[model samples]
Target: MKTIPVQLKSKDYDILIGRGLRAQIGTEVAKVWSKRKIALVSDKNVAELYLKEVHQSLEDAGFDVLDLVVPAGESSKSLAQMGDLVQQMADAGFTRADGVLALGGGVVGDLAGFTAASYMRGIAFIQVATSLTAQVDSSVGGKTAVNLKEVKNIIGAFYQPDLVLVDPDFLDTLSDRDLVEGYGEVVKTSVLHGQDFFALTGKIKSVQDIREQAEELSIHSIRYKAKIVMADEKESGQRQFLNFGHTFGHAIELLSHGSLRHGEAVSIGMVMISQRFEAVGITEKGLTDEIAQRLAAVGLPIDSDLVGTPLFFKHIVNDKKNRGGILNLVAVKNVGEPVIVAKALDDMHDFV
Candidate 1:
């Protein structure tokens, strides 16, 4: 097993990545958690797959485990669902001494992490990420949120996990489409790290290549994010770069009514923003095409003709990155170097 530490002073935690770490979750979690009661949160789909084993593992380790399952989709990340979870934890008499275990993908991680954040003003939580997106991005960053009616992640907090357990073997059960969508995050992380890293991703030929190299790829991506988060935990500066494709992507996701996966929307967002940056002289020409091609190679959409330009701009105005009237969009000078660009909400029409 390879461990990457996210050094955030008092909030410091380790991300454990390997092939069979899930089987040892109880032992691994017991090392950090002295609490007796633990809440295990998962989606229905994931619960059917790995809940029993994980539950048994915790039980064997002497934890009083309470397994909670939500519906399996983005829709489950809602105020209603979060309230239900909070109430359930209350009824079970959980306290700050107890910890939450998020045992599924990004949706579960975000929901459970946020629940932990709001429950009793804040309790500890651990992430046992099953999907590639969770393993690489959401599970490491501490950003947790639930979507509102028209916005994605509109309600959330920066609650760091106590530990993150990533077992690549869990990915063996993912559908082909679910698996490929995660490569979008891998591509985004590579681009942010720059040309050499981007080039490394270019060599991956198929989903099989991604799976075979999951350990290395996941570690690299997690390390990049960990470094940034340690520097700017509250996202006042450098951390905004991590949202390279997210601003436009979230709008597309809301417009699609969750039909578009987060990574899929991000794939298209990166291309759109790159093209706009190039046209405005913020980035060199051909960078857009390069990113689009890389995303396309991994079976992600490069562009979507269905997204209405006006509505897209409407959602951009509501993005959390927007401060006062300026939208703080992350632009690339090239593959690895990212720059934050501030634009008025009215001025956004030119880019769209």
Candidate 2:
């Protein structure tokens, strides 16, 4: 198994990446968390696929496991779900000493991680990322959140997991849309990670190509993000760079109301911001088109009509990146050159 150690000051952990790691879940979980009980959290889809294997593994290690399976979708990431999941943990007699094992993609990770972060003032949190998006991006950042009706990640905390398991074999079962969804994050990372990595990612032509390179690329993206997170675990400075396409991407998500996936929304946001700025002599010329090509190469959407509209502006203003009314938006000047452009919320309308 390949390993990447995220050496944070308060919460240091290792992201274990390999094939067939699911069968080894018990040994892995046992090594990191010495506590007794583990509340394994998963979504309906993922649980149906791999829950039994994981459950048996954990049980073999002598953990009193409580598997909580919720409906699979963005809707599951909510205040109501959060309340219900934690209440279930309380009823199960979970305490600060017990741990939470997140067993699906980002939504499950965020829901389960937050459940761990807030339950009895935070407990052990472990992530076993099953989707390509979770393995490449969300699983490592330690930012746990649940979306509000109109806002994204408004209710969240910086709670690091005790461990993260990224098994590339899990990507085999992803639907075409689900597989393509992950490339949105991969493209974003390639763009932010500089030209060499960008060129490497641009070479991927299809979902098959991505699957072939999943392990290698997952390591690259996680290692890049882990470095930034260690430098700024609270997202105060360098860490903001990780959110290369998330500013307006999040707004587009709210506008879609579940029609657009997070990856699709971010793909559009990345191109839109690049195009808008490149037209005005801010971002490098043709950068937007280049990015759009790479995204389109892997079947990711690069345009969204909902962006730049009045309702979109309303949603963008509520972004967490906005600081004291001045929105600090990330824009690309060139490949590997991303800048934070702070604009007053009032003048943001002029930007569009």
39-68, model 2: which lDDT tens digit per residue?
Answer: 989999999999988988999998999989
| Model 1, span 263-293: residue lDDT tens | 9999988888888889889988888888887
TM-score (C-alpha, index-matched) for candidate 2: 0.98
Against the reference, the lDDT scores of all candidates come to 0.89, 0.89
As a whole number from 0 to 100, the lDDT of residue 38 in candidate 1 is: 90
Off by over 4 Å in 2: none
Cα-based lDDT at residue 320, candidate 2: 94
Clashes of 2: 0
Clashes of each: 1, 0
* Residue 270 displacement in candidate 1 (angstroms): 0.1
